[model samples]
Target: MLNQLIHCSLNSGSPVTLTATEGLSSIAQHEDALLRHLFQGYQKWVRPVLNSSDTIKVYFGLKISQLVDV
Candidate 1:
């Protein structure tokens, strides 16, 4: 993906410039799908409230444009 972005950046008249956002959004959408996939299998182990078996709800989000170098 980085290579493709670089290629688009180097091309002066590429129609692909506007399409970059589509690529980026697709990546983000996949992240949402991945989270849903995880929750589908792992919700059983999560205890949002202790001492109870009540049904729980979870929400998730990502912090954009922030880099963490570990």
Candidate 2:
């Protein structure tokens, strides 16, 4: 599921990218192992998107902070 979401986020249109980011935010909030897995995926797939979009980069940063706070 995470792989599929990451694939969709990487390959799909902007709206799907946004939705996938939002879903990733939710998953990060609730699941530590999944969040770690997500970060591994991030290193491969999501990092480029971060370079392209400030909004997503900031959101992803906030989600990381949320994990730290927990």
Candidate 3:
């Protein structure tokens, strides 16, 4: 599930990218283990996409605030 979301976030077109962002947001708000996994996946897969797109970066900036501390 997270792998698919990370793949979409990294490789899909704009519409899928938007949807994947929403999914990523949801996943990020999960328990610490899941959130940490998601971040690891992001660093490995989605970071390039996030780094290259200002829109994505902004969206993630807001969504990251929803991540609770472990």
Candidate 4:
């Protein structure tokens, strides 16, 4: 998000024209990248756990809530 903001700010004077669809598609791509990165981080943190059943319940339940907002 900070990188994107910085890029936009630095390119503020650049003449870049994006159609509505293009803008939305770019945003969707960024969102997908961010989500994949986040999920990988979560997996790396929790995948070496002790109890599979409890981890599954906790991770999936929390993921479901986050997915709802996403």
Candidate No. with top TM-score: 4
Tell me the whole-model lDDT of each prediction, alpha carbons only: 0.53, 0.44, 0.42, 0.47
TM-score of 1: 0.30
Estimate the Cα RMSD of every predicted model relative to the unseen true structure: 14.5, 13.1, 13.5, 11.7
For each candidate, give its TM-score against the true structure.
0.30, 0.19, 0.20, 0.32
The candidate that wins on lDDT is 1
Per-residue alpha-carbon lDDT of candidate 1 for residues 1-70, written as tens digits (9 for 90 to 100)? 4423322332234232222334667768656754564455466665767768676677999887978999
In model 4, how many backbone clashes occur? 0
* Residue range 2-61, candidate 4, lDDT tens digits: 233422221235432222233666778776765564455354555655776654435443
Candidate 1 global lDDT:
0.53
Q: Report how far residue 70 has shifted in candidate 2, in Å.
A: 33
Q: lDDT at 15 for candidate 1?
A: 35
Residue range with the least summed lDDT across 10 consecutive positions in model 4: 2-11
Better of 2 and 3 by lDDT: 2
Tens-place lDDT per residue, model 3, 1-70, is 4333432332323222211333655555544544454455354544535455554434433333466789
Give residue 65's error in model 1 in angstroms: 17
Predicted candidate 3: what Cα RMSD to the true structure? 13.5
Which of 2 and 4 is ahead in TM-score? 4
